[model samples]
Target: MRALPAALLLTAGGFTAAVAQQTAAPDTMVAKTISNYSAKYMDAECQLTKGHYKVSSGATYLSTAIERGSIPENRLRALASGRRVITEAIQQNGQDKNAAAWYYLGRIDLHLGDVAGADSAFKRAEALAPGCAQDIGKYRRVVYAPIANKAIDFTKANQNDSALVYYRRAAAWYPASPLAPYNLANIFATSKMDDSALVYYDATLKATMVDTAAATVKIRNQAGYNRAVLLTRKQRWPDAVAAFQQYLTWVPDDADAKKGLIQSLRAAGMADSASAMEKKLGVTAGNPMAPAAVTGATADYNAAVQAYNAKNFAAAAAAADKFLVVEPNNRDALYMRARSYVELKKGPEAAKAANALLAVDPMSETALSLLGAAYNLTRSSTQAVNTRLRLNALPFTISSVTAAPSGA
Candidate 1:
């Protein structure tokens, strides 16, 4: 999975399909993920010199059924004890040796450190059901600790061997889960199995085209991104470019991957190719939008720019206020409002904007520095620090919070 799991939001994209059957798909409410692997993918073409690629079509869900729910705690316990949830499932009139039951059992064991048991269970699942492994992964989704998350602390802490044991189990339970194969491919890459990594990377992409559990936009983009990074490492510039382009299919605006595509082209000595990428991205030489997306109270946050440029504190403050009223959540407005507060000698108000900015995005560099700078502005330094820290650490994003900016 990418560092950003925003694709989870896209999982809800299939809600329309699910809602077609029922009023609302509970799974849509949880992951908001949509699987379109069943959609077609044969019309892909790649050209290195032209620095271009094309796909004949995109994807959409083939089936109306959408799976919901997380790996049940009981299933995890069962796998740990070398038990099969399929037993209970069969007794309860569910399918015997159901891949779904086995996958959940394996997932629970995987996280609980019963790596060997998880593997055996997964193998059993695969043996019992061959073509359905990937479909089973939909049942093993874990919000807090998805099986694909190899970068998390617990997996790294135990060393990859232990994690690999469970990961392998997950893959066994869901061969269609592109995430497992992709992760395993990275494992091989790190182990210097470039060839093996490439194979698995291909497998990951192939699996992704059919894996319902990983059809979210985030996961889809991540699959392409990770594969492209590996292709770059292998010095397969053409393939690298192709994979990155596929990534753009999901996240057309990912600056990081776009930068990587340019860098890779440069490294491969494909100047024309690199230039075309630049043209595609408009990065070689293009002016940014004349007016930024500033939702200020006034129409001319730009007019206030003159005062701001002149360092006129009073005028800047007045304009900043107008902007704040109209568009408090605006990034530039928030920063300027905070700055204006400082100049107006309103330390608390400035600090409030700093805090507000932090809520919207804790990673904001300007916000972080200003919040630190505002530390000495008032006796409430301790409060400010704690608030800023909490704002930063909260699991959800501030922009996602519908409430107006605190500074407003």
Candidate 2:
């Protein structure tokens, strides 16, 4: 997936070396520092292309270091040192004059799960000169494309083992791309390879942190939901509860997920809480909402879906919103609205819808889906994690917590 437009924020006319020279006196120290790191970066790229697995491994390690929650002391020190130097360069000489420094900082920020920082730095580098630091096209053509092709061909032949190897190769060569790990996780999950699926699922989430392109965001949404499913299957009650709750924020009306959440709550020794939730959700009721309201909401939802099916995302969002203004807690309308925002690439707007939906039903599947996408798009990993934690801590102690109406 390509980086977002922010990473290509340069104007029509790119900066030239001559222009840079004329801008101000060259800070020799900053230039030398950036040049040295640029050489190392290029060397790493070259080594990766030459089949040096270590280079790719280090890249993968760096990409996932922050996402994994804990880091070895030595690795932490190395990361801090690298970031320090890059910050120093930027402070001493503005990013515009030191394109390489910006480029390296982008790479570092991307690896550290700071997508916004990375995109800004990449934009600065590209603005300095088109060929400077953050060139994804060359990397795609030279590295990712070939291996991805091989992986696809192998998958077409039903050669899972061969496909897995190539997929791993692609992921290892460039950990920034979510395609490899996401697909790998899907394949493993489908094959009931739980352990393998978990590993790739983790990788998929981590990779998504670096690149939140539309395609990657979709994949990340799927991975996040499915990882929760896997956790439930493994009987990891606490984790499953958190995952299912998180998943619901994206897809509020997923009946299966709702049932799973209750099951997880019970299994985690919260049977009383689960029973209360079941009662609040009216799980045993034959029909909940008044028929008139249901019919109206359904009609509005269908109209929204029709627009969405026509790929008129803006229309779909508008229709959903029109319905939501009347039926604020209509699960399907909330989902359609949030999803349309996602398709429209309005990350902040999408997040607003998702957050609003969450306030009514914290476990809405559709809202949660868009929430993850929005957070990734805005590079708000900390916010996303904190949101999950807060949701996980929701009091479901028997009658202590009252569940929202299930669109009834």
Candidate 3:
């Protein structure tokens, strides 16, 4: 017969018998159902000594070694011996074996690359006594981190289905890992699966909020911004305004967000409210109603605006297009084109024009509102809902901001 590797032999039949004989279950060890196991067994006070079957302590020792690095040859053998004893004790003791045993069993299975078995065992442990393990955090690091990373990589490659599986698994295994929801939300958003994306985005925001670490804070901040933008695009004007306001709390001077807030307010049909916000933001004589215009395109801008106000959408769009040809950066012309598209119920065209306007002056409330309306008119209900929810969560108020210079 050929020699077998230690790992193989331990998992096979030979060592199991030897170890079972040495650590037989004690007569005093009363059997109890998994769901009714003694708390004493789960606590650290129950140390493993000679002739005692303490599964969790052994699991802790083995798992700690595995997390530190490769299990030494001696330690590997010891763990194998411990596993055999635990198996025998569970079989003989029946319902008497503590649920912590299953938790430990899961840890061992994970070490052996039997993820399915490990998951089953963990579930069993939880079924018997929910949250039986005293040191669950270590198990999460040993198991879930690699899985979450794989999900992230899959997302990066646009392998969304595979990423979804791993991300969900990672979340199942370690619910507190913000990366899981964040990555899942990102993939859904990219796929235009707005419903799922919004769910995960909300989850990510909630998880990140409780963490005060620098990295977590940064993630939370970005989550707030992204959520608010999504809300704005959904045309839930009131919600979008609220979200943008929330975002401003963290990033008070973000011009784009401020513009977004203003647009949301106006879209909500709160013109007086919008005007009040502009004042609080210190938009005064210096900062005119319109963004700075190219000197030569002033006449074209005035003509476009006049046509728009007159409800001559087609004529307004034409004039704006002509102005854009001369001064592509003219904010007023871009706004007119976008407004005309909206009035004409041309969702795609409106979105295009609004996007162009945003590119030139990203902090224009009017443009943000227009873009959001475009999403709604396009029949993207999920997208619209997500946008509204995200934007409504942001901070919109600001203090002590000088208006644009009195006259360009």
Candidate 4:
């Protein structure tokens, strides 16, 4: 019933530096230890929106409202540094339902890998300004900005050279942004540039997932999940097992991690570990990678798209995780999860998606591209090249960027 702040209102100027140098708590947290002594996280959120979600000066004054409660220094540190979040806020001018706040603040929570925190922010918006959801439905912007849109288009064009040109162009344009390299890393992996993709994926991880100080356990879960998937695809079963094990430690409920662990163990010839995990998750009843029931969870899907577009891969992954909680068989959720892994620099996770993606749509360019990326990043350059070449040889016009004939 309580609300969390909807967004981070990092000012345009000094705030960038504030964010760049933001310090975090150093506690070794296995999971969250939320206490009610802190201000209640209100579920109220605004529906009317203007700009992207985040905090504003008026909401800053609400510091007094929060002052009434005693929050853990660590929690306070998390909030101040954008790791923790408030799901709702009351403005000084008494203006309620600040929809944008939820969107952007969710971004912060997403970046910090706070799935619970991010969800709370969106719930607050739902509670505060329910009308904004209607607008979101009406004028839904394309998730990827113009530059990313071009990259996707170019990749479809199969103009590797020209695609590279545009991809590099976007990367330079958003020099510090993660999505450019994230997308490029996928391509490099597809093109059998596994070593190169790994470099880029590592960079993508740093840009999108890694955090120092008091970061949440979720980021580690995400990064570890991704790494495990990539490693498994590259046939590095031991490392994949270790990575999956690390992911399970953070997200014990991840069916995929459980399945991946089993697969990794089997691949490593550690059949016993694989069997133990299989028995533990009880996948004995059905396929481990079965799609989840995500139909009614449209809100979560929209939120995931926003996070993905904002380049908040961890948050998007978290959103996908929540959706999967409801709908395991949702291919969209699986695809998104794999993408989240790639963006978060978890090659193994991406590989999981890549492999499964082929199952759903073998001819999917994006799926092929992602699989190629995963293979390349994990040191299977030959496989990556093979995948890309197969994609290029498709009957349809392959080069989205270059219109010339195959003979050309």
Candidate 5:
């Protein structure tokens, strides 16, 4: 190789030195800039900038740091700074194809308690980078946990309305988790909101179908059982029978489930099947409406009637339930129990009692009326309409006559 001229060699050396300086200056500036921000904030920015600039990571790290720091003021500042950095990145790069920017934006929104914003950002991120789904799911659970925990606390305190709000938020945040929906179903069931309860129970079942975890299985089983009970209460006998059978498959040894199955079978007009199950369970009679000699439970019957008359509906229902154990076919006791349940706004129990009465006396106008009221309370519009039609078809009787001529 030929030796270079002296001036050319010196010029080449100076050019190389200048190029190195240019590269080193940017690195030094990046390091100093990164040090001024949190590691969490810089991580994400660096990733977005392909390690050329320092910026924090997703909301997860900053949130973790905030929690560890245990200072409310620090949390506020860190979250604000993180949000500003992510927002600026999105604005500069545009969210059109920047998954990291969108993902970090979602994290910041989640930390800021802007659930809807976080949801939108996550969706955008998922659309931009399908590979980020696992990370998105991980962060989604982070948002879900505290909301669900708060809902649980509210439920325990009997603050159902507040519990409902947080539970709904949690469910929306993590739609694949059965926990929030299961708890929501339970709350609706306890409140006697059967239709709403059924919706959430179905959600719980759907979410748990592919999850084989023991806790999830338990939730599915309970949701199935409660759904069946609600169906039976709504007088959806066929659906109730199927739901009960399905639940029994999951918990074959549960006596209450067997009993529910028997009741549903009888209601669905599968008397022979119900009788066989009752015999197998060593039960006296699975159908409360079965024709039988009236048994003596005079004291309990009178107590139930007295409680009902006094407007102590819960006590009245309890007393009537006790009396019916001995005299299940007693029309008076059934009527009192059904009426008391109506007063207590327990649509399902009232419907069950009304149905038993109807089975014993199909032409019972009072039983028809009570069933209609129960269907109304349960929001079973179709059943309520049918009950009203049946009631309207009955021949006018002296007892049903409410008033004489106005002048008379």
Candidate 6:
């Protein structure tokens, strides 16, 4: 009869006989097996002379046999024995620097369902032998998908702590994928952990940059937007402005993003640019104010006056704009808003506000004076001269004000 395969011979009664013979002096048998396998397969002496198993291929075969249910109990025993042997070898001989040893250790840990252990072992193997990086990544990808799916399930169930643990592992396993870090950032954001959220959002963005998949574009855009919002909430106005601008480049017409950009710009003291954007977007200072009310109007007018007194010109103009939403023809509020813009040195905005006041009270000497000052600030000499003529044409009264203080 033809000779049987080595695997079949090992799985048959031969395996039992071998174990029975080794039982009397198990430690010596282990060392002998390591030396024999190392000399046959590796063409070198075993790194640990007292180890149980030095051949990675033998562990691989036993792991496969266990999976196939061929004397699974015996295969499990062999795997356990080999693991302890390798652990002892590493400890005794400082075989931690041995790449092959660590690689096989990772394989054993993976087969045994010790995922964290496998991950650590594989990382050490890759660090020791950079040539093993590709193989390490291939092995890691096997575990990454299942772990990432578990993280997703936990996230959906609102078990955030469990989700975080699995997601962190998944991210480490496959750092090239944006999904893990993106989900992590969302979870942190939901928990009101802005700082942590920002960190993960940055990670997601960095990964997506390298991925360049069409699906990841959406993730990239959202991460950028979320990072900007967090910066805004933290009052890091300059950084928020840059972040919002970057996001807007990806989603130029996003209304909410535009609003965020506007807020950030205003906070960063780019009031002129903010005002220009507001006009471009056809939005007033604050777009959806409360419905017109006498009490609301009174409160807004008072706020404008107080802000103007405090020299917070932007706030004063914003308050007046809100008041005008309620009383569009209110001369006092319009005049206050115009004066605030002038104080802010925003000539175009002052001109626009002065025109609104003029539209309500054409013959008001104060309005004409402000209009002239605004035109002069804008360097519109002809318009300033015409505005001065209009002011002079207005009948003089004791209450009539001379041209607005040469704010230009």
Locate the minimum summed-lDDT window of 10 residues in model 4: 398-407
- What is the TM-score of each predicted model, taking all chains together? 0.37, 0.40, 0.49, 0.33, 0.52, 0.54
lDDT of 4 by residue, 12-72 (tens): 3322332343344321220121222223433213334433133553233233233433444
- Stretches of candidate 2 above 4 Å error? 1-142, 284-408
**What is the TM-score (0 to 1) of candidate 6?**
0.54
Candidate 3 lDDT tens digits, 1-408? 112222321232432542333332211111111112221234322232223345644665554435442435554555565565566555554422366666666555454444444555566665656545435455555566567766756755657788787778676667666767776776666566767767877888888777788756655666676677777767778988888888789767565577678778888887776777665544442322445443444556566777887889988898789868866755556777988999999998888897887555443345667788888899877866765654443221111112122122
Give a tens-digit lDDT track for model 5, residues 68-101: 5456567657766766665555544443356666
For model 1, where is the 10-residue window of minimal lDDT? 54-63
lDDT of 5 at 299: 56
Compared with the true structure, what per-residue lDDT tens digits does model 6 show for residues 267-377? 888988887777664556543121123345556767887787788989989988997886675556778899888888889999999998766545456777788888888
- Quality of model 5 by C-alpha lDDT: 0.65
Cα displacement (Å) at residue 379, model 4: 47
Count: clashes, candidate 2: 16
Q: Give RMSD to native, each candidate.
A: 18.0, 19.7, 16.8, 21.8, 19.8, 23.8
Model 4: CA > 4 A from native: 1-150, 172-175, 210-227, 246-252, 269-272, 283-408
* lDDT over C-alpha atoms for residue 245 of model 1: 77
Give me the runs in candidate 3 sitting further than 4 Å from their true place.
Answer: 1-97, 116-134, 269-271, 280-408
Global lDDT of model 3: 0.59
The sequence of per-residue lDDT tens digits that candidate 2 reaches over residues 230-273 is 89889999898898887778667565466678878888887776
List per-prediction Cα lDDT, in the order shown: 0.49, 0.59, 0.59, 0.52, 0.65, 0.65
lDDT (10s digit) by residue, model 1, range 215-274: 333345555666787788778888887788788776665554776788677766777777
- Quick one: best TM-score, which candidate? 6
